[model samples]
Target: MMAPDVARVESAIEQAARRGDFDNLPGAGKPLDLPAAHDPDWWINQRLASGEIDSQALLPVVVLLRKEFERREETLAALPDERAVREYAEDFTQRVHQDRRANPFQRMLAPAWDPEDAVARWREVREPRPAPTAAPTPEPVAESRRRRWWPLRRRG
Candidate 1:
């Protein structure tokens, strides 16, 4: 699958923040010792001034921040867990099998999802896959052939 778009993620985080989604995140309603500065660039500059190095360059740091924000938004979005994911897969599969549109957006999302093959991907994650065998089994023991051949060819 294609890597998530950094810009899109950042934009989504900003949109969510504007809509108060972050404040509602799980474990986030409690008072936070959030940074005094609200502006991210200002926060970065402050960290720099304090001799705290952001090892990742600005773009990457922004992306990381965006992902954290997205996680918070997702948590607040009250999305389902593995069971829900499994249920969704089963439902979607049934819909497809029945030649129905499970969701209109699925058509748009399907192309990006197709190349990676979700069932195999989920199996890889869920199952303990066995390591590949190196070679076939060796031949088993022979009967009296080895002993007789050795006696016949004994050094005289």
Candidate 2:
């Protein structure tokens, strides 16, 4: 009763499972937690994970702009000198402006990405992310339900 495509996909998955492809794989038994709605960045994340897609080649000018800025920031961080950093910052700003001008959606362009803030953005990207701190301890368990945040007046 299975559709051809579905059966083929199931067979492939079963074959992979039999070949030990699932053995010791991280989160093997866990459910897939997908986003509730379609996510724009999810496609790019999947492309990057596969190693087959060149980030630079991916489309939609805004996405390219974001990725380009990130790449530029990484390159600048490694060899940042005042002159080089200043030049790249200026060039990056110019490129962002060009992208905005070329974008078909004039509304999406207006005040969407302020190229003027590129230098500040660059500084943020170059900064290392702070380490994850331990989670704050939960509040002590209350002895009675009546003492909870909202005191309930239970009529006897």
Candidate 3:
């Protein structure tokens, strides 16, 4: 037997469906199949699979999954086995490697260009140098070595 609130929600959903309110609604929170663009391992293996994502291109996808996980983390943690998480992570890694290999130029160019070195070189080129100024004149030492002030003096 369903709870009364659940039954009421079901009825409302059914009514909404009948009235075309839910007819063309897309799966708003569903993960994109993303076999090629987002899940390159799936693209490489030619089998679409649900998994973790760690690619820069798939950052948005990861963010969405993270939000979902955060929302349902307790439920996920309560599951008997966490093997699925491992499997998913492996699948994501494979996809990312496959995607990385697809674009040889990007892989080659990324490491070839060093932004940090370029910035350092630019600073070296544009650094300001101190202006030429007259040498500092040293004060003359007193010829006599007499004490400037007596050790003790009484005021009159």
Candidate 4:
């Protein structure tokens, strides 16, 4: 009951298998976890998960810039000193400046990050945290701790 095209394709696959065309290929033995529905980024995500591509290398310039912006505070925290944080922030913002798109349509793929604002935000993240202060003591409750119970109602 198989369609002619399906039968033809099956015959072709059998022939290829006999010729060892599918042997020794990468991930040949491993089963792929394909989704039931179509996914545009599935391959890219798989490549990242399999270590075939680095996160930074796989990410687009615009995406990378956005990721940098999102991780700005964490990056600053990881730096040994404020100067290092400032340098990183400056470089990140500069790169973002280089990739900015002027056209409104094209701008969707290349986001603009203001270098000055990035630097300022970095400075804020790098500032020393204030010393912890004791929390104010709670005031005692003023309501009476009375318990009330309803007596069984007399048969109406």
Candidate 5:
């Protein structure tokens, strides 16, 4: 009942086996190393573990938003000025609002970031710490009277 192409392939494989083409190959006669509990997303997990793909790519929009919220400091710090930070916060808030509106039934919704709060936080993080008190100036050291060493003869 096999298709002609399949039967031909099977026959060719059999001939190759008989000819010892697959003998002594790597992992011959060994059982495959499979996990005891099958994971449906094993390939995805493998890629994530090996960093072949970005982890954020597989995250839900809400989760991604939450992660962004958590790292807002770093993101805002990279911006050149307060205006850029304010714009970023506004954009982030808008996206959160949009996502909430679009996915009303989603179980885990990311809380909307307050643009004012974000700006405040950015300012707080950007504020320069009070300059440390200047250390007491060290007393001037007396010049040493030791003669200098040199190989050149005095031309006097």
Candidate 6:
């Protein structure tokens, strides 16, 4: 037996349907727009696409750290000097260690990043790029050899 509230809701829905409240509605007879392949994170993707959730916050801490490691050059390039880069690398390494300690189960996923190695990488990325060689100047053409086209005049 249905509860009184459920019975009342069904009756209300039936009354609305009879009154044509469900007719002429948007996509009433159209097939659902489903993905070609099933996606487990469809709702999360929709929320991300609709700007309802911050993509950065949605990533796992380990994943974030890995991304930071991958983009270390870009991060280091923004620093003012070697000292700042060193500090940042140290801080990043400390955070990695702390995360490993806090989540021992995730230790396998969060590889330890060496601060010294990060400093070396920063130096390599900071190296100045060689100046581009100047293009060879073209020899000037003789005035007599240069052709000039005259605009056509209307004969009419």
RMSD of each: 18.9, 17.9, 22.6, 10.6, 15.1, 14.0
> Considering only N, C-alpha and C atoms within 3 Å, which residue pairs clash in candidate 3?
40-95, 41-95
Q: After superposing candidate 2, which stretches have Cα over 4 Å from the reference?
A: 1-56, 70-73, 104-156
Model 3 Cα lDDT, one tens digit per residue, 1-156: 999999999999999878978655576557755544564466534331323333444444434444443443343343343354444434544544454566545422112213344334334444576899999999877769656675677799
**Candidates' lDDT values, in order?**
0.51, 0.68, 0.50, 0.72, 0.84, 0.82
Per-residue alpha-carbon lDDT of model 5 for 11-111, expressed as tens digits?
99999999999999987999755557998877667667879898878888889999998888899778877678778888888899899999999989777
Candidate 6, residue 92: CA error in Å?
A: 0.7
Which residue pairs in candidate 4 collide?
A: none
Which of the numbered candidates is closest to the native, going by highest TM-score?
5
Give candidate 3's whole-model lDDT. Answer: 0.50
- Clash pairs, candidate 5, are none
Better of 3 and 5 by lDDT: 5
What stretches of model 6 exceed 4 Å from their correct place? 1-46, 131-156
Query: Comparing 1 and 4 by TM-score, which wins?
Result: 4
Ranking by lDDT: 5, 6, 4, 2, 1, 3
Scored by lDDT, the top model is: 5
Q: Candidate 3 or 4, higher lDDT?
A: 4
- Candidate 6: global Cα-lDDT? 0.82
Clashing pairs in 2: none
Question: In candidate 6, what are the lDDT values of residues 1-156, reduced to their tens digit?
Answer: 999999999999999999999999977999755667999877677678879888899777888888888888799778877778778877888888887778888644655666677678778888998999999999999999987698778899
At residue 12, candidate 6 shows an lDDT of 100
TM-score of 1: 0.21
- Model 4 CA lDDT for position 6: 100
Which pairs clash in the backbone of model 1? none
Clashes of 1: 0
Candidate 4 Cα outliers beyond 4 Å, as residue runs: 1-49, 81-83, 101-104, 109-123, 144-156
Report the lDDT tens digits of candidate 4 across residue range 42-82. 88777788897877875567777787777767876677765
Consecutive 10-residue window with the lowest summed lDDT within model 5: 141-150
What is the per-residue lDDT of model 1 for residues 1-156, given as tens digits with 9 covering 90 to 100?
A: 445797788889899999988785665747644577586577567667667875455443334434443353333234334554455445544544333243443332221122224444454555666998899888987885655435455587
